[model samples]
Target: MHIEVSGLYKKFGDFQAVTDVNFEIEKGQLIGLLGPSGGGKTSILRMLAGLESVDKGDIVFHGKRVNDLPPQERGIGFVFQNYALFKHMTVEGNIAFGLEVKKWSKAKIKDRVAELVELTGLSGFEKRYPHQLSGGQRQRVAFARALAPEPQLLLLDEPFAAIDAKIRHELRSWLRDMIDRLGITSIFVTHDQDEAIEVADQIMIINKGRLEQKGTPWEIYKNPQSPFVAEFIGESTIVEDASSLRGFGNASDWPGTKALIRPEYVEVGKPSDFKLLSATESGRVRHVHFRGSEWLVEVEVGSTRLVTYRSLEKEIVHPGDEVQVLIHRAYLFNNNDSWIMENKLKEDPMPVHI
Candidate 1:
């Protein structure tokens, strides 16, 4: 079902948890509410699930106001981060709990639980207790229990936070596939940027109890609307003055603006290899870190420190090495931190001949 949150606000005593947050979710879309801890993301999710009261605003589910409706009346299936499964109950019993609460026939509950067990890949573990199952297995039981009731919406709060990294990766792909097959409208909250980008059809970024930005992963990464969004979404170098750079033109007309340069767009190499002296800056490498398949080199150019990512196949520079940095692309923002223009260098930096 389509969900609309308009002018939503939530307060705790004197502190406000959410401030005038607004967004909409299309039916059957898997969206993510992404933000750091204590940023009001959980508060927003709780409010949507009817677990928390709304201080002010309207939460409309398919044109019907659900502000006063209880969670069960809202037709939402919620899965908590800790699994929240019954320790003494078997998997089948846990899956059947929701249906039982709704007063479904004993035969119907059995059928539904069987269907969910198979769908969630827990076919042979129906009799296993929560403590007897692995982390991934317990997560499956939680998901199955949440889905057994066939609710109109599914809400997952950091569903994979407790699983190991390897299993978490596997479950993300599996869950997306299962949700799509069932055509369930789902919203999951997460602080992991990579997880949100990889899992959600759309992402809403929240910070300090305010909605910073909302868009597809690509859009949010490529064209951030504000400085906070740009910095939070990816690694960026903040250039306080464009005129200070070698090739950039005079910026007297544009005062009090800055430029954001991504690491991927910066080239680090020997000074002899640079063809355009105007676009290059010399800096001493402060540190070098091995990042799985690549290297992250930190360089000190004057008072500013810049980070550049280089492939492992390239020549690795060590700390204290004097290197030249070239910029190929940058996004300019005004004093208000709104995007002003994109600067793409006319000539690509000449490749370093190894």
Candidate 2:
């Protein structure tokens, strides 16, 4: 089912939690509500699920307005971050609880529970209690319980936040597969950028009680509409001073504009390596830290500290080594923080003397 949120607003006493938030989810699309803590992401989800009343605006499902409907009447399944499983109940009991509440016949509930058990990979653990299963297993049980009702829309609030890092990664892939197979319209809340990027068909970024941007992960990362979206979606360095562009490029066209440089777009090497370097900046390496498969090198160029990610397979440089930093690409934004253009410094690029 398609969902549309128009001019949605929510308030908690004196502070407004959501301000004119609006977005639409296409049928069977698994979208992600991504933001930091207390950024109104959960509030928006709650409002959509009918857990919270809408202070303003309409939430339309398919073609009907669900603003006045209760959560149970909305035909929406919700999964909580903590799993919210019944500790004393076995896996089968938990999964069947929703069906039982809906007054399903014993035979039908039994058949549905069995089907979900196999689908969620919890067939063998059906007789086990919540405490007996691992974190990932418990999460699967939660999903099974939520899906038992066969709701048209699925809402998950930080579904994998409680799982271990390794298990979370596995569950993300599994959940995406399950949702697609079921063809359910799903909206999940997460503070994890990687999770949203890896799972969702579309992502809605929320900050300061406002909808920052909405797009596919690639669009949001590569062509951010604003500086906040650019920095929040990925690693970026904000260049404020025009002098910093000396070795980077000519900022004359966009005077007083701020530039965003992504760590991966930067290249660090010996000064002699870049024969036709358009722009080159010299900086003292402040620190070098290992980031699993890559090295994050921090360099201090005057008062600005820039970070660049280098592959571990490449030549490694130590701290305090003076290196020439090459900018292969950059995103410039006007004073209003609106994106101007993405400058690719590789072909017919700006020239900078090394």
Candidate 3:
């Protein structure tokens, strides 16, 4: 492990911020720490960065215990959400500030700043001030400054939170290219699931200062271990079925299992006869949001709710239109509890998005 955190615990006064959190991060890999606000993602990052002390636990980076190491001595780069740049400094000066403090000679600092500016696509903006640059440009400047000193690992805390959606998407793409090119080991924290899924090599989900799950984007989206994780990372519907979706248990229309279906896997169709429940179908469209080629439609089925993204090509489903949905691929969980993988139905007709 490049960075290993074990039994990490932190508390403030009466509030317990983090408890028994443990995970190992490999080198040259990009990982995402994802959760909503106040979920302790930032707290964990701060602890790793030595900005906050760990109440209990050990932090090992490249086989060295860094508990007592000062933040600067840890050799970890930090990129914050606000693109913290020296407002008075020019782009090149901002990028060179860290190296200058490290006492690098003028020629070496010049070369380092020039290389970073080129690598970050800021070659022509060397003389421009932070306020003179666009949000994306400012972000690039912040990144260049953070990375100039060649830190062992990079930590990003909600780095794209302040940018607009379009800009955020663009910057995420830009970041993917730069990090891959540099082969840097980094961990970024964000509250957006889409950001984590699209950008991270592996994702760590946090809730209430605890680790909920950690895995590839596909694995986490397809096979969530907990209910909170199942509902959070992607658009999914959980159906209470009378018969288990998997054949592990008796196949009868009795109180059985919870069926989970991703919106992309759901189609407007009648429930097949082989389905768990008898013709007990009830739903009405509540609202629809058009998403270019497809539409995200929310429906209320009895007391439960489901969201489906239907393409306009097949039957043209819409708002206020009643639908008989076919859950092409669904996860089946026992009604009694979430454990016991029983009565699973594979051989789905629809394609599972990767």
Candidate 4:
């Protein structure tokens, strides 16, 4: 289903939950609504589901306006964050609930239930109750229940929020693959940047009840149009006076002398490791954390604290040890302007005297 939301706005009494938001979704594209709590992601999803009334906009599904339509009539399947399953119903009963509501024949409901149970990997747990299943299994039941109706559109609100981190990560891949195989147009709400980046074909960033930015994961990460997106989208450190860093040029060259640096942009190691050794700035290691495969090292340069990752294969640097730090690029921005600051050494390759 192709969706077009224009001039969308919503409010709860005096509190404005959603501002003039606008975006579009093509058919069978998995889009993610990413934002912090109370940023209107759920509200927007509810509005699309016809559960919430839009204060001022048009929600067009394939060129047809659906603002006045009820939830059942919208041809959408919604799965809530809490995995709203019936405690009394068995897995088969739960999966069959929607089909029964539509008054499908008993034999047809049985066939559909069996098909979904197999598809969702719950074949042997048909008679199991919600409390009898693990969180991941219960979530699979919820997903199967939602998919039973075979709606044109599927809406998932933090579908993995209730599961453990390990299971959540596993389910993310499962859900993405399932959606692709079924070719259902899906929109999921999540505050997890990793989940959104891994699952969504396109991501819509909501902030302060407004649409901050919308693009693919790579586009938004590499080129943030606003400061909020720069900080919110990745592991970034915002420096107040980025010009103090070597090879970043002058303070006046940036919009506000403020720069955003991701861990990938900063390289820290011994002086002999870099060819442009003179262009590197001197920073002392403050802390190092073992992140399984690599070490997350924090280095203090001037008054700014920057984070970078080091391979475990390399020689480790201890705290208080001075090391060479090179910033390959930075996202510089102010209220009115935003741009990337590529280190001068990258272009010149010559040693910087500073």
On lDDT, the leading prediction is 4
- Candidate lDDT scores, in order, read 0.87, 0.87, 0.81, 0.92
List where candidate 3 sits over 4 angstroms from the true fold: 238-261, 270-283, 300-303, 318-322, 329-354
Cα lDDT tens digits, model 1, 1-354, are: 899999999999988899999999999999988888889988998898999999999999999999999998999999999999999999999999999999999999988998999899998899989999999999999999999999999999999999999999999999999999999999999999999999999999998899999999999998888787888887878988865655555444578767777887678899777776656788889999999989998888777778889889888799999998877666777766565342334365566678
Where does candidate 3 clash, by residue pair? 246-343, 246-344, 247-343, 247-344, 248-343, 269-324
Per-model TM-score, in order, reads: 0.93, 0.93, 0.86, 0.96
Which 10 consecutive residues of model 3 have the lowest summed lDDT?
242-251
User: Can you give the lDDT of residue 41 in candidate 2?
Assistant: 96
Per-residue lDDT of model 2, residues 86-199, tens digit only: 999999999999999999999999999999999998878889999999989989999999999999999999999999999899899999999989999999999999999999
Q: Where is the poorest 10-residue window by lDDT in model 1?
A: 337-346
RMSD of each: 3.3, 2.9, 4.9, 2.4
Tens digit per residue, CA lDDT, model 3, 108-206: 999999899888888789999999999889988999999999988999999999888998999998998889888889999999999999999999999
Best by TM-score: 4
Model 2 has a clash total of 1
> lDDT tens digits, residues 1-354, model 4?
999999999999999999999999999999999989989999999999999999999999989999999998899999999999999999999999999999999999999999999999998999999999999999999999999989999999999999999999999999999999999999999999999999999999999889999999999988888998989998889888778778886656655668899999999988899987767889999999999999999999988999999999999889999999999898887767888878876565554788
Candidate 4: segments with Cα more than 4 A from true spot: 349-354
